[model samples]
Target: MLNAFHFQQPLWLTALVPLGLLAWWLKRHRHNDNAWQKIIDAPLQALLLTEASGKSQPALLWLLASGWLIATLALANPSWEYQPRPVFQTDTAQVIVLDLSRSMDITDLKPTRLARAKFKVEDILAQQKEGLMGLVVFAGDAFTVTPLTRDNDTLRALLDSLSTQIMPAQGSRADLGLLKAAELFKQAGLHQGQVLLIADGAERKTSVQAAKVLQKQGYTVSVLGVGTPIGGPIPNVRDAQNQPIVVPLQVSTLQQIAKAGGGIYRPLQSDDQDIQDLLTSGKTIQGKQARQSDDLQHQDWKSEGPILVLLLLPLAALAFRRGWLLTLGFVIIPLLQPDPLMASPLDKLWLRPDQQADQALREGNYEQAEQLAQDPLRKGSAAYKRGQFEQAVNEFSQLHNPDAHYNRGNALARLGQYEAAIKAYDEALKQQPDMSDALTNKAKVQALLDQQKQQKNQDNKNKDNNENKKQDGKNQENSSSSENQQKNDQQSGQKNTEPSKNADGQSGEAPQDKNSAADNHTSSSPKDQDSRQAEQKKPASDEKSNNGKEQKKDNQFANANQAMDKNKGQEQPDENEDAIKAPPQSSQPAPENTEPRGDPKRQQAIQEADTLNNEEKLAAEQWLNRIPDDPGGLMRRKFKYQYQQRRQPAGISNQTPW
Candidate 1:
């Protein structure tokens, strides 16, 4: 217990000088010329000293100093007791170390060895559902692609930008790559994980030693070879006599590295067998569940700072008349004031407006969060969370930023106003063209709009059919009623006529009425036929045009879905899948880049591929597959900075930049 005594913040002990430690310091540095204290007795000195006197006032000085020391100790927050805490962790942690040396430029495997490795990485990502994965790339030096995370999208996005040209230096350094993998585990506060090294081979001899060190640290290292044993020369390079430098796959070196690290090694394969084997080699700790149960009852150190502050009361009591009254008054007066009390809620005294709103949001108080939010963006987000999409749109409409437009589009979409949402997305794209979310959402909303229009057309067609049937029934009823009236009129005429009158006028009039009835029927028949023909022609033309438009838009939507499925499935990509094909109404370009390539006629580098993989093997076969002209721009800057950091220590060399 005595050995456990230590300051939580030892630097705060400096405050002891101004409090009680200054007793000796004040004596040596005293400026007062009070010679009477040398001759005067203790009682006489106490009687003669005033409140303003410094060195003469020993009791008051010592009391204030002791109290200050106690207060400072409380602030330091010393702890002695412990409280239990539960911790949960997973053993499925892996760090993939990739080799980005110049030799990876060999086109023996697909478009290049590096491209095949990227595809393998994607496969592993898709397989690992609940594991934390990290990425590190190395050539002359190693650089982290990302820390251990369960987010596969981030890994995929970063992986797309990697290339042989991304590395600052141009040589193999597999030893540094292994060391970097170990560093990733240390940073994640994990002792055990699998280190998967995807490389052709190691050029440095120290790679075996580095692997051994990593294995000793409880990490199981694995290697996946990514090249043909037949060997291929590095692209765009020649010897002094203009001879290409041919480099073969060094399978033995990779095997040695795996053996030293106590892991398994496999060559790259088309199937998922290699990844499954690497994943199975994970080092799982024994009794994990038992340890977790015991850990739930653990004890962490409980800080005793508040209790220690009690010692200051007695010491401060002596200085009440002189010291603590002023300090205490300064602290209490602000709270006693009425200004801050009227302005905001009690939480505002401690937390910022945004913080208070976030706390309320976390507590499921969306209305309060909306009220507390000052920024338009936050207010809109809170309203959206509360299911008030109209209010969210209103709040988002006040801002001009791209994110504001995007959020407004979402709100409009939730309100079932797809056209408005699409317009909002268009506005967002106008400000930031590279916004992928906007592009994806806009395409979806457009498809939805097309479907909605098609449904409306079908509904109108049904309504027209019902109305036409009703009109035909009414016309038939009127024609039958007219015929009955005509029949009744003829019967009344016969009853009014005299019997057996030989050449009566009623007979001649009856014949004339019959002929008039026949003429009316003939004229109405032709008019009805012409009217029916015109209506049928108009609807037939409308239906045909609607079907054509629907088919065209539907095909565009299907193609976009197919492109996304290929991306997610990591399968062969079509030659036409250069860009996500959107409908004619969309503003996005069909091709990713308009900039010319080596073959100006063929803007893509897809022609330069290997024999093993099919033409549609990669959705992004080349670096220029996306909007960014240089896909590796971000990695180039990162490795450049890291390489410079390594060179900062002037006394040591970076082992000939390898």
Candidate 2:
């Protein structure tokens, strides 16, 4: 059947497009007079004959024009299907799970089972131009060594990098490997695929569960057994020393694992016939419905399209020398040249909206500059030197750049609108997951929030402490005033008036005389006096309670000191330490003009500075005599200072300049 693909030029086919004004003139002026009579009217018959020949040339030109027209259409690379029909097919994901266990080292097949398997997989992958392929290795445990992807180059590299040692542990668990492969597909959203298991049957029973999981996840398990039923002894080889060595491997178990995983097992044999049979065996499984499969025969219509054009191109070239050249040029050139307005440099070196925005920023006209930036990047760029996040965000928002979104997030964080900032940052991160600025800003905002929470807690604590202190002070003052009143009452109670004295230096009213009676009473009531003295000491005890409050303050100070010591031991700054540290400042010394010294000490110092934290760097710079303006001198200064700061042990007080 011949198919033309049903393509045709529109009503505007106006082939007259290339003929210009002369064609219009001919059409407007041509007259249909009697040709013989007109020829007779001509001055000479020879002249009339010449004119007829010239008319033939015009016919030839018309033929040439038609050729050019055809050439132009051919250049479009049209394809005509003999019987046009769409092919409907479903694709499958195929994963090759290889066993990288030490057992693969066995030389049952000339080189080894592992080597042969690798070779076979490489060949298969090379042939598989369509569909997805992946690699999994099982040794000790099963894991996906590579994900299913169309890029064979990356897959092959990952495959080549596989070795027995890569697994770390030693055991063949085909079930585990298959399960892993199935899980990989699940994660990658591959619903159906084939699992080609290539291994020496060493881990059948151990990995049965993993294999079952793979089967449940809707994967076809095709086990290619790579060892004999009558297995050979596992190899034992020594390095240089004459020492005993052994490595045991089981191949039989692998076949059983494959069978358990709902797959038919094929034995790996030395003969080529067995290999061929293995490659084509068991396409269908018993008691299970097969999925719609992609046909092995694929049509290369895309490739054939170009070929058709190529074939027509030469014919078009032949027509180029004919009158058809103008017509072809008229048709093809208009289509090939892209609209000039839409053209862009691949590297983006040319001035785009984003670049224009950047230029505006450089010129310091930030407001005007942001209008030039584009989206997903409307926020300008992440490369801000001085935290101009607001301007960056504005420009970036225009471009809709995610980095700009992240930059805006940072700016919001700095402004202390943390929750909103975090949301903005999350938006930024969603657009560009790997944005370090977004990550860093997220961490920073979280840290700030934590610090603010801590500070608020401290403030609340201090407030409570102050309230308690006030209450205690009030209690102390009340107790002191009450004691003074009690003392005054005791003094008033001590002063007493007596009526008369007794004749023997006592009052006459000895029984009635209270002074003589009181003297007798005092001797008998000494315990009462001791009780009074105890009452007097009560206020002093109260005063001692006040002293205890001082001890509590001292304890708080001790705890603070201990915390500092603890921080020093860890060699990492705590939040309080970080708060105390000065903010980053660019006081970097200018480069030195002097040549670098060969001195080891200077070199070590330079290295130290290079690695020093901000605090350490600052400290080191302080130790330098004078930072030089020259690059070399600056390097020496930076290094030596940083080294000294880093090398200093903890407990060395870092006193800041007042």
Candidate 3:
């Protein structure tokens, strides 16, 4: 224990030793001076050399010097080895590299591959005897989560909090993990250390090369495969078939990496044989070394600084002059005085405003916390928690950091401003391109925008369909009205023609009577008979002309009916063609001797047809006006041209001379 003794402040002891010796010498010199002064002043010396004055005094000066030396020793802060219990010692240091890739989330083992690996790590830590252990967690990149430390509890706590989602990138980069572990061991001043890889063995080609380099550097790499050979599908992701995508353990890859590193590879098992093998392997390597140093043992030492301070109390009491007041003052002042080095316990327990504000935030008092927050980022975070997205956006805009921008994007997204949120995410990516959370959110927002666009297009399509249905209904109603009006006109024309046919029959009877009378009277005259024959032939020629005209009128009515039927399905009728086909009504009356024509009925039918055509044309114009202008202006112009053509034909007559 004495050999292990060391001083934390050796300079204090170095300077204090000489000062203590000088103090003792000065006390003796003062005594000698007093004696010489007594001999020089005989009269005064007689008084000074009285019994009280010459009485032998205690060694107060020596006591004071001794106290000074003791105080200096206390200041030196000495420490030494003091073993309270036996400790296991070893010569090796180990680094456990934990893989945090997404593949580790697969449940090939019980609970999950990562969970099992964590349990195994805890067991390994518990079994570790004297060696310093470090932790490294890696995914696409690697980082030293903890340096070489003898504190197992701290390592376990860090391990418990780790998951694949905590990693900023997602992929197996075993090479980087090994490199980080090597660096940690080097920092710990270990020329050779053991590396225990706990992973699913999803490694890249670079992993093998890195393992070889680590082997060259005297690191014994041992792999404990967390997953089984027959793997399971990873959760939260699926293939095109909507089934979970299976991920298998890369046994060959792990074996190759172990070979390259000149290490051992084994699957994790329920038995502790694999862990025992690792410990035995480390011990074997230690035994192969030329000699073991005391430093490798890593003994824990207790500081003797406080013990030295305790020793000063006795020395101080011996140095003090015998006085009740001085003793009381010395004891009371020190006990009453506060320690300047540290705060009081009560003060430490008290909460500060900032701390209270943080507590408020944790308790979900976001508005109150936002008011209390002094930092811009904290205020923004509080505002975000309160669901005040616009306020949060304003606060976060003042900050220029990746996390702030990423959070701002989330707030904007919540407010349904997807485009703005995407821009904010872009800014975050500019600061940290590998921010997976931001990338994932940006993709989600983009998908939402696409969905909104699709919904808008569907709504417009529905609206157009509704307008077309309405137009079809109106067109059907107009065609029915036109058919009814045409039927009424046909009936009226037949009624008017009946009277003309009866009158013609009456005129024929009269002509027959006249011919008979002529025949009887002219029976006696041959000249009279010849004249009557000529009159009969003239009547026959006139009747043939009348029949030809009536047939032409019938053919015209048939053509008009066919045209109406052809246009019945059309939404917009060709009014110009109807006007061109309608014949003009004759105003002049025919001579009585000639065939009497049905002019009045024909005029009435023509007037009614013309009025119906005008009404149809007006309806078409109204429909044209209701249509919206097309983007290209082509559809609007086409409607306008059709409307103009329809209106022009409404003025033309439906009737024409045969």
Candidate 4:
């Protein structure tokens, strides 16, 4: 409906109306012109009629004017003066899931599975319109190459970049691809869109799971199987001195993935024509007559109009004889020149300073070549030979030649500049991409970097731990010293107190009054504080001293007991008897003239009291008080009692005079 209404030039319509009116009027009133020449010579009139005439510039001018008018009308925002229509008949999105595994490298289907799939993708793009399209590639790992988009060109470019070699870890990851495709479909919000999976099913697990998930999400999948049932071995490609390295194709894993993904498994026919047929035959295909209601997109015709005019010049030259105007148009119009600067000369030319350096090195002028090689424009060969790795690095910085970079990397590696070497190699690869020597060298450098980094980290950790340990040891020592000092202070205070009594019925000497004791103890034992401090300072040493002191005391006690026994044995028998028979006396003399030895009873009491300890002395005093002074005359009774006792029995008393 939108195609019906269009803007037109009012001048053209008005001019055409007048011309039509004039033509009608002229046809009714005009008479044929008969010149006098016709009467003079009818033959001349016939000759004029027979002569061929060439086309005029005015007709071509009119044509050009009309074309310009039409173009102007188009630019005036022409639109249908009718109802709006939908651009898409259906709101379904479509996804093309391609298999990019190395197995796709198998040439069983003409070029390869990948090539066939790509052709089919182009066909699918050509067939379908509207909604969105997405590309998914699956190998060892599957990922969306491009999300569902309306742009077909971008999708096709994305497909072009895909290959089995992209993922080195080659295996058919059908399940993973399908699962990811399902996620994509979910993100795309394609409710009824189709999932077109193009893969030779190697692993069905992922594809099946994806299919189920998509079905649950209201998405349908159609599979285009890309490998034969009797699968071809996956080829392993390599470089054998510029020759193609062809390995056998592996089994097709995308087949089951396609089937499990709820897709129709259409075997990949190597022929482009065959693949085209299979893609278009499905119920999903939209025909050329499909009603597509798109907005009246106005293209910028101004640039195109001039270009069209330029294009018509050659045609004009061909059409007209002696077409000087067309020739002049071609000459006068300035043609766009190619941008020479856009392409770098360095791209085509290899200005290898290193190669030049190599020639210098071969000539035995190492130092000169090395110096020259250090120039930014020079190659790295001379620097490498001279063992000037850093200089080589500087030279190769500009060149970016692969072999030069590789040599520079070798030099840097010799100098232990692994990371810098990697950078050089990376640039070299940027210039000469996919150079295995550079790749292997880069990998080696990376590994070295990793090891060096790991070692450095370990060293740092160890250093930190050692520092912490030392700090902890110092802290522990300080804590122990403080504790010992506190213990020493406590011992000093305790030693100042009166000596503690033991169970041996002995009291220690009286502690001096506090003032005196403090002074005396300090003065008498200045070493006491020092000893305590020293003991605290060296507990183990002090412990040995305490043990020695206890041993010495034991020796002294044993010696004293032995001395007493020897003294007893040395005494004569009679002297021993006499000593036993004699009345006891106070060991110390009484205070001068205060008490005499003649007081036998008092003397005995005093002797007994003297033998008692302080506690026992009080009991002895009480016993003395209970005894009477004397019952009779002391001398008479004493003599008679002694004689009678001695005469009565020999063993009864010792009163017999000797």
Candidate 5:
């Protein structure tokens, strides 16, 4: 500890020389002595000039010197012990993205490109000292083999298990691999990292873009080209004939990706040099940041100076006896206050309201711009951008220029006054004949007006059709009901006449009539066999007739829907729900018993058919459940979902599957 003791900030020790001089000056010409001389008269100076031969001594000056010496020593930042710290955050966080494409199955290296790539990664993990390392594999899509972790054994085990067959699809989608690396870094809470991509070749355009994205997020993308320049044919992959599909190393393309990602690119080597170079990619990647090796997260020195501030406690406590707390605060506070004369470039202190408004508009503060703008046109534009369309229209209405008229039209259109919008746009066209925007907008608004009118007409026609259909249905229903009622009355009169005659002829007729009434009542009850049979028959027949009518109604709706394309925008009436209602059930004509609306035999046959269908569906489901689950099913589904989500709008390459 004694040998290690040294000042972290030696420059602060220089302050001691100046501090000693200040203390000596105070001892010779103290303020209290100077003030006493100024207050005393010449005759009284003789009486007042009293000298103490070191009796009390100048304690204040001594105290000042001691405090200054201690503060200077503390400010020098004394340190004795060593602390562990990372040289660069680079080596500490890395994600290895390995390609599992079919081309990786090519025997370019000793065994296979993928196998050699795995060995190279093993070399990296073996060489790594202190860092979190992760594994990711990608073909058609990427998956996290393992998140950033320190368990090299687990990573190696997982790496050995990876193969081309395990991937859901086969393509050298290194873009997805790089993105997966980014995800791993983020998952592990690493703000920055290195992504080492091992692949024979990748989709060039997408891979470059992916590298750039990672670079922006402070992640470098280094590539280890896994195939030779003199390429080899992919094993088990051929064309129509026995022709092998050759996959080559995209060396130049990979270099471009490295450059874009602010990293280094190296081809697969026999030694660990490639891995070593990748581990130190951050040195070149972060340049100046890597150069200042001592700086950790914006701080160059972890000074123990503040801890030494505890030595000032005695001096601080003594200062309170002389009211020095308020005295020092008053002196320091004035110096700490901002300079009144100097102004920042953004200061709006001297700017006019309109000038400030212009500045606010330039800065994209539309609300502030609208509030401060003195000009009507400027205020209108600001209001328009803020979505205050009504206020924007009012503001623009005050101005008569072509831009103002055009802007007013836009606001009016937003307010759903298409006719008024067209008029405003016309005004703009009159002012500037070649105002293409205004002319186009005028035509659009006119078309809107025309469409609105046509829709209203269509809605009226549909309403009339619905009303006519309802009235006709009602007429048919009333007629059918009246006719049925007449037939029922006639039948009822015949039934009563027979019973009444029998009752009038015999003295025992009353008892016989009562017995017959009781039998009729029993037959009408729902629980009775006759009543249940009648009800069961009625529903099936009614349903058959309803289904036929429903089909006809659907046809009508379909025909109307074909031509009803216009939007029912704000111009349409809201009170049309009743007029546009579906046909009432009470208005439908009764089904005829003569027609085959339903047959009991037919109903029974349909129910039996439905039961058979349900049984077959259940049997099919059970058979499906009997099949064993795939071990790779989860990975396949995950890859499929990711592939769907991440399909680039700019199409993927078709040059080679690898």
Candidate 6:
């Protein structure tokens, strides 16, 4: 062990041993200036101070240096080599014989007899250690699926894929399976090997004779019957009546075989005690081969590092009493110690501006953190967290990293600059082709922009609808006013025509009444003439009153017609004024003088979409189409799924507007 000893970290020895020598040199050259100055006169001070001897302990210094040297050697990680000593190992082999006959497919055992047998074999394989195992699968005949080998993986693979379909014929041939297993044992040149027979126990009487032959050849035959005594019918194999042919476990036949073979027989059950017992019995078989020994060289290094550390303990105890050395150690130890609060070892190694910024951020000094962050990525992150999106974008743009670009996109998106955000995300994807967060956020922002566009369009549509309604209302008012004016004009015309008709009637009646009055006056007596004159005076008074009233009516009619015409003219000017002031309705872009309507961001997106590739344009359109009408959330889900499939990079936080 001592001869084999070598240091694992010999480089550390070279580095640390020099430090011990430096400590020795400093101790040896040390001076006591104060003590010498006290003893010297002013004139002789220089000579006395130079020549004076100081209290020195070379032995103590040597001890301290020796302690350091030992500690350094300990750090060098000294160890020794290991040597291999030969020992006896048991040589045991087991051959598992699996029945693949149609009878094994019977389902009296939960799933099927064959399935249960396979499970039991798996359990045995799991428990088996330090042994070579072989597999023998049989139907009408037997064949070795795997030769005796220590490779359990190959064995399990062969066993797992085993089925009756692989067999050439269909029948229970336990005797043939046993013979095949025996052949494997013989090939391996083993005097004793255990044979585990897992089957549904539907075998010929001659199978017992085969077991007896295997027993004679030193094979321990253990039969594990894998079906119920009252078994179920084998699936898909029918009788003449087109009914399933039932097959039961031949427990007595399996027992007879085990008895003849000088081994125990057990029925396979839900509990795997039978397989466990079979494995245990196989372990009991001692190695029949002669024991062999060989000597091999190996590293068996014993650690002497801890022993060196123990040696320093006494040296440190002595050095603790020396005031100057103790003070020096106290100062040096603190300098060597790592910061306990720092999580990253690399951070502890270097005092970077980002680390300081991170600390400031943790302390809630966001502004100071941003100011201190020298790395553009870190500064952008700080600015973003503080809701200074524009500042974040500027800071992030300075860096060429994908994360920076992605973060800038986030910032731009927050500012509602969606087109620019999409461009930023595109840049991020170009930098790191697998930047998934950028893709997801890009899709989200694009969708939001589209939604805004749809909303803007809807708003414009609504505004147009309202304007149409207003115009209709104005038209209806104009039509109503014109009808009222026409009615007034007709009334005035009727008044003028009615006065002429009344005058014609008065002229025609006056001539006839005058002639009749002349004839009556000639035939009347003198007294009658006097009374007629009085009556005529009364009639004249009445006619004058009637004429005055007629004149008053005509004047009033003329005044009414003038007032109606004046009102009609006034209303016509108002209608003309309304028509002149009203804005023209058209399905066209706004004039250059007018401000562009709808969300500016949405318009910008639509404009930017013209510059995008087919895939991107399609994505943009899909996002835009996810309007309020998407009650099924189909568009939203599609966007999410596509983004997820893109597998965007992690690390960035997504806080999209939509």
Candidate 6 weakest lDDT stretch, 10 residues:
649-658
Give per-residue CA lDDT, model 2, range 1-658, as digits (tens). 1354533333323444674454565566454323554646556655554455447645655555555466455454344454333454435567788887666766766587677777777776776666677887775455555688877787776555565544433445566677778877887786666788887754344466566666776676777766544444344322222222233334455555666666666665444543344334423431122234423354433313344445555556656766466786899999998776664545446677777777666777665554555543433443333466565555545544575566667666666778877888888777876566676667668767877875564344434444455666665565566556655654565569444565678645546435444443354345745654465455445444544554455456557657756756756433234224311110112223465699788899788779989987765654342232222333245433543354333111331100
Best by TM-score: 6
Model 4 Cα shift for residue 387 (angstroms) = 53
Please give the CA lDDT of all the candidate structures: 0.73, 0.56, 0.68, 0.55, 0.72, 0.68
Q: Model 6 reaches what TM-score against the true structure?
A: 0.41
> How far off is residue 598 in model 3, in Å?
98
Model 1's number of clashes is 8
Task: Give the per-residue lDDT of model 5 (tens digit) for 1-658.
Answer: 7887889889989998888688677667764554567888879976877656333346655666778888888889988776655545433678889988888887878799988998998898888755688988887668887888878788876665677766654556788889889988888776677889888888778899999999999999888889898889875444433345677888988898888888889999998888888877754554454345445543244567777789788888887676775788899999988877975966787898999898888999999998899899999989988899999999999999999999999999999999999999889978886676886777677777887875564344444444445555655565466556555655565575544444346556676556655554443335544644555455445444445455465556555533332333332232122113312210112222353548888888668757767767676554444344344445545655665465432244253444
Candidate 4, residue 638: the lDDT equals: 36
Rate residue 133 of model 2 by lDDT.
Answer: 74
Model 5 poorest 10 in a row by lDDT:
582-591
Clashing pairs in 5: none
Q: Name the candidate that leads on lDDT.
A: 1
State the lDDT of candidate 6 residue by residue for 1-658, as single tens digits. 6677799789887777577577867766564435655666779886656442333555665775687788788899787855454554556888999988777767788777778888887888787756788998876456667889988887776565665544533456688789889999999988888898888764546688889999998888888988877888765444433345677788898888888877788888678777777776666653443232123344445566787798877777777766646787788999998877746757635767778889888888899899888888888888998999999999999987788889999999999999999999988988886665777788889889997875564444444434445655665565466556655655565565423234545544455445544544454457755764665455445444444454355456556646645656644443233222322211111112345579798799778878999988776665554433333233224323443343222111221000
Q: Estimate each model's TM-score.
A: 0.37, 0.36, 0.34, 0.33, 0.35, 0.41
Q: Is candidate 2 or candidate 3 better by lDDT?
A: 3
Clash totals for all models, in order? 8, 44, 6, 27, 0, 12
lDDT of 3: 0.68
Model 1: per-residue Cα lDDT over 1-658, one tens digit each: 5566666777776776665447777677564447776777868877986546554466656666667777888877786556667665544688999998777888899889999999999999898776678999987678888989989889998887898767765557788888888898999887778899999977546788889999999888899999999879875444333445677788999999999999999999999999888877763432352244343355667777889888877665655756666787799999998864455566468999899998888988999999899999999999999899999999999999999999999999999999999999999989997687887788778778987986576445444444455666666676676667666765676687654332643446566566657754553456664765566566556555655565455568668857646654533232123222211221121222345556754633455443326534553343223332555775777777777566422111333221
- Cα lDDT of model 3 by residue, 1-658, tens digit: 7787888788887867677578777767765645556456766765655545433343555565666677787778777775454444555788999888767888778799999888899889889856689998876557677799988888877666676655533446787789889999888888888888887764547788888999999988888888877788765443323445566778888878877877788888888988888767766765544245443334455667677678767766654545533765888898887877864647525877677679779989988888888877889899989888899999999998999999999999999999999999999989997687887788888888887875564344334334444655665565456556555655565465432234445535465446545544443345634654455445445444444454355456667656755765454244434334322211111112433367787778667757767767676554444344323233223333443343322121221111
Q: What is the lDDT of residue 557 in candidate 1?
A: 62
Q: Candidate 4: global Cα-lDDT? A: 0.55
- RMSD, each candidate, Å? 28.3, 27.6, 33.8, 43.0, 32.9, 37.3
Q: How would you encode candidate 4's per-residue C-alpha lDDT over 1-658 as one tens digit per residue? A: 5455554333433434444565576556432233444464676775655323323544554444444444444344344443444344534466776776555777777777678778888877876655577877665455566777778888766655565544422345565666666777678654455677776654444446667777667655666666565656443222212223333322334444444444455555645654454444433443322334243344331222233345455545654655655666787675654545574656424656666565566787887666656455444666556677777666766555567777777778888988878887877878886576777777767778887975564344334334445655665675467556655665687686766574776665453245444554354244655755454446434334444453354456446636644665753343333323422110111111346669899979878767879767655554444343322233223333443343211111221010
